[model samples]
Target: MSNDRSKPWFAPKRYGYGAGLPITWQGWALTVGYVLIFIGVINFSEQDKPGSNFMSVVGMSVFVVATIAYILICAAKTKGGWRWRWGGKP
Candidate 1:
């Protein structure tokens, strides 16, 4: 971790008060949530009329479940005492 703000995105930085990036669970949550939300929006929009296409409804439900599953997975992984590594095992 370096304090050089000019470093590239690939470089890790000590991001907090004392330097060093703080642990980021929000990132995973946001990624999963955004993806699912986008998929749901697309499916919902494509379906056009409601109560007509069962597959669309199912797909929408799956999207919601996947989003929730991602959140849970991220939460468990992040809070279970495992170290966060960038490119290799921690």
Candidate 2:
């Protein structure tokens, strides 16, 4: 916050742009896992099988909804600011 550029990237800033991501490394891991699940869902829905279109729609909807939820949770935790690390004060 004091214009100290030497701060670690994961450290929370006091003044500037506020916290970025609310979650910590664990949250990021979960996000990555979710992305993998999304990809798998899309791939399965693209197969040459019946109800592929319906599956695709459902999968996309789930992904979108989950993402929005995650963002909202992060925002709420960080008080509407970006955070580089998880937990603790923003």
Global lDDT of model 1:
0.49
Return the TM-score for each candidate structure: 0.37, 0.49
**Pairs clashing in candidate 2?**
19-82, 19-83, 20-82, 20-83, 21-83
Cα displacement (angstroms), candidate 1, residue 62, comes to: 1.0
TM-score of 2: 0.49
- Give the residue spans of candidate 1 off by over 4 A: 1-37, 48-51, 79-90
* lDDT for predicted candidate 2 compared with the true structure: 0.57
Q: Candidate 1's residue-wise lDDT over 1-90, tens digit each?
A: 865333221213223111122244444445656686777668665866766776676777777777677545444433223334444422
**Candidate topping TM-score:** 2
Model 2 scores worst on lDDT over the 10 consecutive residues at: 3-12
List model 2 lDDT by residue over 1-90, tens digit each: 474333223324555654444245644665576678778777866773674577777777888887787655444445444645345455
Among all windows of 10 consecutive residues in model 1, the one with the lowest summed lDDT is: 10-19
